[model samples]
Each structure stands twice: as C-alpha cells, then as structure tokens.
Target chain A: MRAALAASVLLVAASAAGWWLTRPPPEPPKVAEDQTFEDMDRAEYEAWMQELGYTD
Target chain B: MLLWLAVLLGMRFGAEHWLPALAAAAEQLDAGESMPVPPKPTGLASLPAPGTPGDGQRATLLSPATCEAMVADLRDVCWQSLARQVAPADPDEALRVCARVAGSEMVLECHADVAESIAVADRARAETICAAIESRKWRGQCFFGSGLALAETDAEYAMGRCAHAEVYQTFCRHDVVGEIALVDLPAAHAQCAREEGDWLTRKTCWHGIGKYLARRDTSEAAAACDASTAEWRGTCYHGVGWGGAERDADATLADCSTRGPYADHCRHGVAAQFKRADPTRAVALCESIQKADTRARCLDFVTR
Candidate 1:
C-alpha cells in the first residue's frame, strides 16, 4: 500500500512538473491602428520592394 | 518564461525610453562621418550608351553602392538596399544607417525591415522590436515580414504573427499564405479553410493562393480556384484578376468574362487595381458588372 501511494505521489509531481515546463507564454496586449501606402516615403517603398525581392 | 514576459512588457511599456538613446547614438555616428561620394565599380568597362540593348541587362548586376554613385537622384534607395543587406546580421548598425535617413517614414521602414531580418532566427526579439515601432503602418510591415519568414516552416505560427501586424495584417496573409501556396497549393487552401477570422480574412487567404499561383502559371491558378469550395471561388478568381493586372491591366479586365459567374468579382478586383491610376477605366469596368452589390463595391473602390 505504501509503495502504491508513493508511486501515485511521484506521478502527480511529474505531471505537475511537466505542465510547468511546457506552458503557453503570456502575450502582449493587442492594439489596432491603420495607415496607407500613400503615407509611405519613397525610401520606405524602395526598402519594401527590396525586401520582397522585386528589385536588387 | 518569466524573463520573456518581462521583455515583452518592457517593449510594450518602455519603447520611448530606448528610442531617444538610439537616435542620440545615430546622431553621434552621423556627425562623425563625412558624406563622400560612393565609389564607382572597378574592373568594369565604361561607355554603355543609353538605350543600348545590353545596357539594361548589365545594370541588373550592379551593386547598390555602384548604382547610388551612378544615379544621384535615387541615393536614398541605395542606402535602403545596403541597410537591407546588413539588417539580418547586424540590426543595430542597420538601424544606425536608417537613422541618418532624411525621411521619417524611411527610418520607420528601417526598423521594420530590421525586425523582419532578425525574425528568421529569433522571432521573440523580432516581435519586441515590432511592438516598439511608433508608426502603425511600419509596425504592420515589420510583423508582415516576420510572418513571411515564419511561413517557410510553420505557417500556423506565421498566421499568429500576422495577427499582430496592425493595418497591414490582411496583406500579411496575402504574402504569407501566398508563400505557402507556391509550394503546397492544397495545403494552403486547407489552411485558409481552417483559418479563424472575419470574411475579409478568409477572402484574403484564398486570394493569396490565386495571386501567388497565378504569378507562376495562370491556367493552373485558375484550375486551383475552380477546385476550391464555392464560397471562396469568387475571392480566388478576384485574386487572379489582381495578379494579372500587374503585367497588363487591359488584358486582365478582358479575361474576367471567361470566369463565368465569378467574372464580375474578377472585374471588381481589376477595378480596385486601376482605381488609383485610371479611375475612369475602373468605373467603366465596374459598370460592366451584372451583380448590383458587386458593382456598387467596385464603384466604391474607384471613387474612394
């Protein structure tokens, strides 16, 4: 009986430790705002084009 | 996890604290530097006369630095290209380069691009960088970049990143899912089906498949769209129209009729593309749509 009890205790502890080891991370608050390409500078546009590989 | 949470909190709350420091450092560096003209490419034959047949092909091989020296007008573009190359490895130095840029928008773009570059290896750091950006537009672009890089391996995670991208979030899907579509088209479609969002989000997800696929092969893209569920078929067709417009707007508009029931939606997409450049043509195309609601939306796109 003592052996079974100890195994149960060990199992519970392991499960708890597992949960602690792999948990979902806390995320930042969601904020919403909008802007358009018209507001983008030519340099910024060029940078985007380069990022997209549209130009060298 | 605790440290990660703290870092996120710091980014959310303390961006203002670091920005000035970065600016000051940038200023110090800028003041110490001299604006010397960029050097010309060595070991290159000169005298490529303008309009020469091979001249344009050779220009494509020139480095950004060489281009900057050759075209004095587009100096900022050259700097941006140089910074883009530096961002993935040394973001701080890239930011310093961006800081000296005359335009504030370009500065924000530099930050966004740097965030994207680092996201390939360290997404957590990239998100922190994105959250700290002041402009909503650039922040979205930064997240979009992160999502694009992440999509190569874990598309679901990339979609999660897309959620953080502010106004440009819709476009993030357009490119991120579009990237996936280029590889496994069916999987891309399945992802769009499982995606949880508003109608616009769902529409853009499907649109991405059509847009990116159509860029490679129009007929295949069309077949892929036809294979999709009826609910999003029109959306995909619209994407095809948009893709085609990049090359030839007139041909794209004319080809819409071949789409049958979805033709009006295709025309709607074409009209949207033309709204900025040729509003009259866009309105005329909108008028051609038989569907009253779609026509109204197309007209709205043209007028607005």
Candidate 2:
C-alpha cells in the first residue's frame, strides 16, 4: 500500500510538471502603431503654399 | 502524506500558470519610481462651450484681443528675422512661407513678422506675399494690409487698381481717374487701353477727365482736350459733349469734328442730339458736312 501511494504521487507530480512546461508562454505586449515625420513635413509645405498666393 | 504532496505540486503548477499574467498587470499599473504622470489631453477637453463669445463659425482658440497681441509680438520677431536675412535665394519660396505664417491662426502672431522678413529678404517677394493675401475670398484685413504694402512698392496700375478697388469701394468710390493725377496718367491710360479689350479703357479715360474738368471751364476742358493725344482728344471731346454740353449740338459737332478719325462718329452723335433738340438745325448742319452719304442720312432723319 505504501509503494502504490508513492507511485501515484510521482505520477501526479510528473503530469502537472508536463502540463506546465508544454503550455504556451503568454503573448508579448502588442507593438504600438508606427508614425512618420514626413506627414508633418507635407502638412507644413501645404500650409506654406496657402499663405503664399498660390490658391491651387 | 504522498497524496498531499501531489496535491501541493498541482496547486503550485496552477499558480505558476497565472503568475506571469498577474506580474504584467501589476507592472502596467505601477507608477514606477518617481516618473512624472503623463499630462492628460486637456487642450481638447478644455475647449470653450459652443457659441461662446469667441466660438462662432470663425472661432479660433485665441480671442481677438489675444490674436492682436500675438500679431504685435510677431511683428517684432519679423523685424528681427528680416534684419538677420540679407536676401532670400528663392523669392517665390520665401513668399509662400511668409504667406503661410500670415494666415495661420496658431501662428498668426508671425504674420507681420513673416511680412517684414519677406520685405527685408526681397521687396518683390513681399509684394507677392501681399498679393497672395489679397486674392483670398474673405480678405478685408489681408487686402488692406497688402494693398498698403504694395502701394509702397512699384507695381503697375492694374495691381494698384486691384489693391485699392475693394476697400476704397467700401467706404467711398475710388476716383480711379483722380488717382491718375498722382501717376503718369497718359502711360496708365495707354496701358489700360491695351490690356482692357473693347471700350472699357475709353470709358475710364472719359471718366478720369472729370477731375481735371472739375477745376476748369468749357474752354479749359477744350484746351486740355487739344493738348491731349489724338485718342485722348477724341475722348475728351466726347466727355465734353456728354458733360452737359450736348444741348448745343451744332457746337459739339463743330468741336468734335476737329478731332478727326472719330469725326464721323462724333458728327453722327451730334446730329442725333440736334435731332432731339432742334431737327431743323441738325438737318442744316448735316447738309453743311458735304458728304453725300452723311447729308442723305441726316435728311432721312429730318424727313422721319
């Protein structure tokens, strides 16, 4: 009876350890959206032209 | 005891499953070691109520008084920038940049600064900036400011006309002809005559004489006409006839006949006036012109 109980305990411990190791790691934090400096440059250019008498 | 150990290990594994997630949540929430809190977006949040004093269709974040103060500040900056720059390599680009500064509400304090900068950089560029400002639809302030700036520079009469026409028209009619006294009227008249197709220039020329005529009697009006170029003389005679002298139809015909080229047209115009005033005198004067075609036309009118 002592031997059977010890074997049962070992089996349960092995199964739990296996489950923990095999499970996927939590996903990494999501990357924030990328932005470009060019958008600001273009906006500045448009604003400049509007000030100058080039209506188009 | 073995079963209890197995249960402890299972609980440990379950705890392990949630531990990383819990750690991440805590990290995200943590205000971590003396770092400043990010400022909230108060600009958007603190916007004034709709329809408030400074919040109509043309509402700006700055009040009018605030904008004026900013404009004054910009004027100083503009003067400083202008002093530093000798010339702009690209006048067109400079004009564009200056114009932009002039128009932006956020940067409006920079408008006068930009204008002064352009003036120091390139006078032509400054004019271009003013012209651009003048062309916009709702341009009361822009037009007046730019117009005054342009007047300081030497643009053509047309540009001056464009600049002054809007504002001057608002308060009082612009005596375009009267303004010509301050300019080279003959050259301006010729330029206008060339650029404006049809009879617009002729009309303007006639209108312009009202200023000179206002100071003169009929003889001086005639002498001024005589001293004028042939085209202008013709116009001057026409002006005289139109300016309350048409009652003496025969005299107008005699005066205008001396101008030649337009003589036939003038004769016909006088004849029409005479027919209105005294048909008999018009028939006699038409007969005296000795052109058979003219005489016949005159007789036809008298007969009619």
Q: Candidate 2: how many backbone clashes?
A: 3
Model 1 lDDT per residue over B121-240, tens place: 678888888899977767777777778766766777877877776655656766777777776777687788785566556666778777767666666777878877678888787777
Poorly placed runs, candidate 2 (over 4 Å):
A1-56, B1-195, B199-219, B222-236, B247-266, B278-287, B290-304
- The all-Cα superposition gives candidate 2 an RMSD in Å to the true structure of 34.8
- Candidate RMSDs in Å, in order, are 22.9, 34.8
- What tens digits encode model 2's per-residue C-alpha lDDT throughout B1-304? 7555655666577667767775665564342211111111011113223345543533222232343455664653443333213123344443334343442432322332234334422455545444455322213222333332333233253234333323221111113332332344454344334434223333334433422342233344455455555554544443444331344444555665664554543454345445544655656656765556655754664334
In Å, residue B53's CA in model 2 sits off its true spot by: 45
For model 2 the local lDDT of residue B78 reads 49
DockQ agreement of candidate 1 with the native complex: 0.03
Candidate 2: the clashing residue pairs are A51-B99, A51-B100, B78-B113
Candidate 1, which CAPRI tier? incorrect
Query: Which window of 10 residues has the lowest lDDT sum in candidate 1 chain B?
Result: B35-44
